[model samples]
Target: MRILLAEDDVSQAESIKAWLEMDGYSVDWVERGDHAILAIEQHQYDCLLLDRGLPKATGDDILTHLRKHQHNTPVIFITAQDSIQDRVGGLDLGANDYLVKPFSLDELSARVRAQLRTQHKGTSQILMFGSVSLDPQAKVVKLNSEIVNLTAKEYQILYKLMQHPERVVTREQLEESLYAWGDEIESNAVEVYIYQIRKKIGSTMIKTIRGLGYRMNLDQT
Candidate 1:
């Protein structure tokens, strides 16, 4: 998953970023609220880790602006304030979860998982399309009960396709999901990944549209 962390505390940000990255999340961080907003506007994110107090703009202000613009992305306020009123205020401002500073990394990870689970409308932990199953959090993919070997990028493509079974997720959208800020992307990277996925999974599992993009063929599933 992709996440945006809006925090000014250098040590704290680095710690959280490193931890989340280790947990298989693509994380981009900005130290200022305006930069956070700009990042939000530029790319898609699975979640937002926002600090209540920020430079130039407050986290509440950022959340308010996002809501005003109809961005329903899940937000977790990572702040030092842990009072009753403070918690209520953050929730009222549309935060899906809240984590106070001096918090355990495991707790933060748990809350993030919870938010993602709630965001997912699926009824299963393993996303399935026919005999193929994917444990996203575990970064594992199985073809009919047999574990399929996949590189990180290959897993990313398959997971993206599985998430939107039969739906056409454009090349640009897939590229964004596969890459983080400042990461170099090859022109044929998407095609290469698709080829790798097809070789690992069944060829019929994915279909390429001439003008559009790739779509998972779940009808046979």
Candidate 2:
């Protein structure tokens, strides 16, 4: 999952970034609320972790602006204020969850998982297409009753495909999901991965749309 973290404290931001990255989340850090707004406008994020106190703009201000602009992306406010009024105010401003500072990393991780689960309407962790199942949290894929070992790129490609089964997924969409910022992508990189997936699973699983792209034939048995 992708996350945008807006925290001004350098050390605290770095620590949270490292922990989240270790948990297999792609995170972009911005030190100011304005930058956070810009980042949200630019990229699609599963969630946003915004500090209540920010430079130039406060987190509540950002939340109000986002809601005004119809951006319903789930947001969790991280603040040093532990007062009941502060927490209630943040939630009323459209924040999905509030975390007070001096919090445990375990609790933070749990909150993140809870928010994602609720935001996706309980569709964030596990994805099922026909008999194929993918556990995003565990980064595990299973076909029928057997566990299938997949490389990083392979898992990402498969996850993207399974996320929207029975629909055509163009090559460009797959490319964006696989490569990061400035990573080089070969012309047939996605095709090579598709071939690998078919070899591991079954050629009948992923159906090509001729000149279009590919789709998982989930209805087939």
Candidate 3:
């Protein structure tokens, strides 16, 4: 999954980014709320971890703007604002969850999971297509009951494909999911990952569209 963190505190942002990355999420961070807005416009994120006291644009402003434009991406406010009214105000502003600072990393992780679960409500977290199966929580993919070893990026690509079986997933979308700000992307990076995935899971499983992108081959038996 991909996440955008809008936090100005350098040390705290680094720690949060590292922790989320370790949990199998690709995270992009911005120190200013305007930069966060630009990132939001540029990429699709699974969630947003926002600090209320952001520079340039406040978290409340961003949240209000997103809701005004009907952007339903899940957002969690991670701020030092700890008053009851503050929590109530944040929730009223459309934040799905709120975390006061000095919170445990474990709890933060759990809250993120909870919001994701709510976002994907009624959809099984374990994705299945044909003979392949993926467990997002476990970060494991299996083919015909056998484990398939995959790098983090490889798993992310496959996960994207599996999420939309038999539907075209654009190359740009896949690239966005795999890379964060300032991460170097080779021209053929998506193709390389696709090549590696096919080698491990079987080539016929993913199909390339001549003028578009790629899709999971649901007819692959």
Best by lDDT: 3
Per-model C-alpha lDDT, please?
Answer: 0.88, 0.84, 0.91
lDDT by residue for model 3 over 1-221, one digit each (tens)? 89999999999999999999898788999999999898888788989999999999999989998889889999999999999999999999999999999889899999999888788776658898888999876668999999999999999999888987878999998998998877789999999999999999998999998679999976784
- lDDT, model 1, position 45: 91
TM-score top scorer: 3
Superposition error at 10 for model 2 (Å)? 1.6
- Of the two candidates 1 and 2, the one with more favorable lDDT, higher being better, is 1
Task: Please give, for residues 1-221, the per-residue lDDT of candidate 1 as tens digits.
Answer: 78999999999999999998887788898999999999999898989999999998889989998999999899999999999999998999899988988999999999988887777645447888888899866668998899999987788788888877868988998888877676688998999999989989888889998779998885666
TM-score per model over all chains: 0.83, 0.79, 0.88
C-alpha root-mean-square deviation, candidate 3 = 2.2
Q: What does candidate 2 score on TM?
A: 0.79
| RMSD vs true structure, all candidates | 2.8, 3.3, 2.2
Please report, as a residue range, the 10-residue window in candidate 1 with the lowest summed lDDT.
Answer: 116-125
Off by over 4 Å in 2: 122-130, 135-140, 150-153, 170-172, 175-196, 207-214, 217-221
